[model samples]
Target: MITSIAQAVALFAATNIDDIVVLSLFFARGAKRPHITRTILLGQYLGFFGILTVAAITSYGAVTLLPAGAIPYFGLIPLALGIKAGWDTIRGIDEDEDGAGRSLALPTVAAVTFANGGDNIGVYVPVFVSNSPQVVAVYCGVFLVLVSAMVFLARFIATRPGIGEWLERSERYVFPLVLIVLGIVILAEGHAFGL
Candidate 1:
């Protein structure tokens, strides 16, 4: 359980490294602070839990329909997503942007988060499937707490021009690298590559 919490934190942090920058950008907009903050936080929670719920349901199906030993193969999903994200980053693509003409409403932010979180589901499913139900709950709880912290941290950093600028500039490279490395770790740990 302790290890699960720690792993959950690491996964959440790694997967959300770019979120701080995005949230910072959103905050930099002329919108009211409270409104933007509320939207970001609420959107993050809704998007996160929505992904988790789907992953949990998928986990249930995988656990029942597949052999226990095959569960680790689910790690390949994140590995592939990470590779694609890295490629997109290298190509200067921004899939995280809100859809065309999508206004920055609470629902819009939530939808954007959900859309950008394909890798989240990939990373989440294997973890959720392999763990006991209690551990999954623990991971979800830890993730929710971390999401709040991430919002607060992003808001604080957004208020600082220098730090926010640095994060925005660097995250383009750093975030993809983190995702790739996380994928490698997940694959190696789960033996998803049949190593």
Candidate 2:
């Protein structure tokens, strides 16, 4: 069970490449206000890690009593989000989001993290059910790694001539497919966990 959870965490984290990439772009945009950027990071950390902790505890408590059948539905969530992301990319809406004109604050970054991490819950439910601290650690580690990757990748791509436009243009075509794949993986995990 623990091993399974670990695998799931690893996969979940790896699947978040798009988000890491998206977030990197946000940071690469010169971070209008350094202090505001820091606040956003703080909020993002607290919101994402904090919620993950809660999910772990909640799963630990109720998993035994919960119907195993309800598991796959949780996986469906990332699928939906991924699909939406892909759709947004396809529809040109993903590129429409720009934080440039806005003032940054703890609430803003935290809010963005919360919105982005919605799919985390879906990917995490099975991990939570397994009651593995290692799984939690894996999640945290994965999150941290992704965050770091986003920061560097975005910064790098931004520095390169024309890469920023390239990324923005590609996500519309690619983002929704990520959601679909995540959804399928989660649903499969749900079935595996049940057995």
Candidate 3:
């Protein structure tokens, strides 16, 4: 159980570190509106639930249909996404520019969260596939707690005047780099390259 908890924490942190910047931006906007913070939180949770649902279902399907030895091939998804993100970065394509000046509604926030989290499904599926059902539940529990911590930290950073701006500006660079590293780590850890 202790090992499961630790694994869950590591997995959640690796997958969701980029979300801090995004949540901070939302919180920054929410600071002005005041009432939208609750909406943002709700939207984040709803979107994350969707991501987890997809991962869980996909992992279960993989476990049922694929041999256990072949499960690590799922790591290819993140590796490919990482390479795409790096390529786009080199081409100076900024996909995060969407939703500028848009109203912060629940649906909008939820949609953005889900879209940003598309890569998370790739990472989660492989890890979840290797874990037992009990361990997966532990992972989910740990993830929920970390999500709350992430929101609180984002709110803190957003409330700080200059920090949010700095993070926003650097997120484009950091995001791709992190994705690339994460993909490599996932692949290496799963020995996907060996297979």
Candidate 4:
């Protein structure tokens, strides 16, 4: 289970790679500003760590407080994130205006980061469902990886050549497809758990 927790954290963080990419794209479109990106990333890290802690605790608490069957019901988490990402990707897949994008405010960045990591909470419920295991360390590992990668991506993209204004034109179709597939998988997992 320790390994699984670690793996889950990795998966959770990796799952957010797209968000980093999208943010990177936005940063590239905007003027390069390490300080701004740092501020945004700080908030982003806080969101990631905060959610992970809550997820670990909630999963542990839920299993003890609720019925065993109710545990899997939490699978809705990653499912939703995947679906949202997929849909958003489809809606904004264009690569235009890569460096002309604006940086988000700290709170907005934090909120977006939280939204991006929303489904990850479900990743924790399973850990507790089986044995009430503690996955905090693994979650922390994932958080570290995510923050590190995000910082690098933001820095790299902010200085890279711009793509002009076209990111939105193409993503419309792509994101929806991602959403549908991710949604189905999550729903399928939910079905299995219910059984």
Candidate 5:
């Protein structure tokens, strides 16, 4: 149980580190509006759970349908997403910025959160498949607790003076780089490329 909790903490932190920037940005923007904070929180939870649900379901399917030897191939998902994010970065494409007049609607925030969490799915699916159902339940519980903590941390950062701005400025560069490194690590660790 302790090992499961530790693994869950590590996995969630690895996959969702980028989310802090995104959430902090939302909180910073919503600071003036105030009413949108609740929407943001709700959307974040909904989107995160959506990612977890997909990961869990895919893990179940993979375990049921694939040979044990093929499980490591799941690492390709993050690798592909990382490469795509890198390519987009090279093209000077910026998807993180809000449009001039866009509203912070619940669906928009949820969609953005879900979209940003593609790598989480990639990492979670394989890990989930390798664990027992009870361990996965423990993981989910840990994740739930951490999600609230994450929101609080982001809110605190966003309310601060300059830290949030710095994070926002650096996020575009850091996010893709982190994803690429994480993908490589996952692939190498899993021996997905026969490394």
Candidate 6:
């Protein structure tokens, strides 16, 4: 149980680092569209859960086909995502477009979230594959709470202006590092790579 909670936190933090910037942009736009914040949050939730459902389906299939001992191999998914994130950072690729100019719309925000989270599905499937239904339930609950907290934090930072800018600037370095460390943790814990 404790391990599941910790894994959930790690996965959420690793996967959602870029979301802070996106959410901040959404909140900033909320000034013009009064419903922007709610729309962004709702869209994010819908997109995130949609991705999770896909991961769950993949996990179910993988578990049924693979042997129990091969479960840990799923850690490669996050490891690869982490490496890609780090590489993107090194290559100066910006995942979050200057959301400052984007028009606030529910479908657009949801589509952006869903597309941006392609990497998340990789990480989520492996984690879900290693867990039971009950553990996955706990992860879902924890993820819900954390995502809410993230939205609030992003909204607060957006309203602040200064903090939001600072976060956006620093997040480039910090977020990729978080992904790398998370990948290492997942690999280590799963005893992948013959460790």
Best by lDDT: 5
lDDT of 1 by residue, 152-195 (tens): 89789876778666655665565455545645655565576575
lDDT per residue (tens digit) for residues 8-103 in model 6: 999899988977866775565444445667888888888778767767777888434334444455445445644765587688664345444324
Which pairs clash in the backbone of model 1?
Answer: none
Cα-based RMSD of the predictions, in order?
7.7, 7.5, 7.2, 7.4, 6.5, 8.3
Q: What is the alpha-carbon lDDT for the whole of candidate 2?
A: 0.54
**Which candidate, 1 or 5, would have the higher TM-score against the true structure?**
5
- Segments of candidate 1 deviating more than 4 angstroms: 30-34, 62-103, 162-195
> 86-173, model 5: which lDDT tens digit per residue?
6776887654355332135676557556656666777887888888989989998999888888888888887776876765566556
TM-score of each: 0.61, 0.51, 0.63, 0.53, 0.64, 0.61
Worst 10 residues of 6 by lDDT: 94-103
Worst lDDT run of 10 residues, candidate 1, spans 95-104
lDDT of 3 at 131: 85
**lDDT against the true structure, each candidate:** 0.66, 0.54, 0.68, 0.53, 0.69, 0.67
As a whole number from 0 to 100, the lDDT of residue 19 in candidate 5 is 77
Candidate 5 — worst ten consecutive residues by lDDT sum? 94-103
List candidate 4 stretches off by more than 4 Å: 1-9, 62-103, 128-135, 162-195
Off by over 4 Å in 5: 62-102, 164-195
Q: Which stretches of candidate 3 lie over 4 Å from their true place?
A: 62-102, 164-195
Query: What are the clash counts of all predictions, listed in order?
Result: 0, 8, 0, 30, 0, 0
Determine the backbone clash count of candidate 5: 0
User: Which candidate has the top score in TM-score?
Assistant: 5
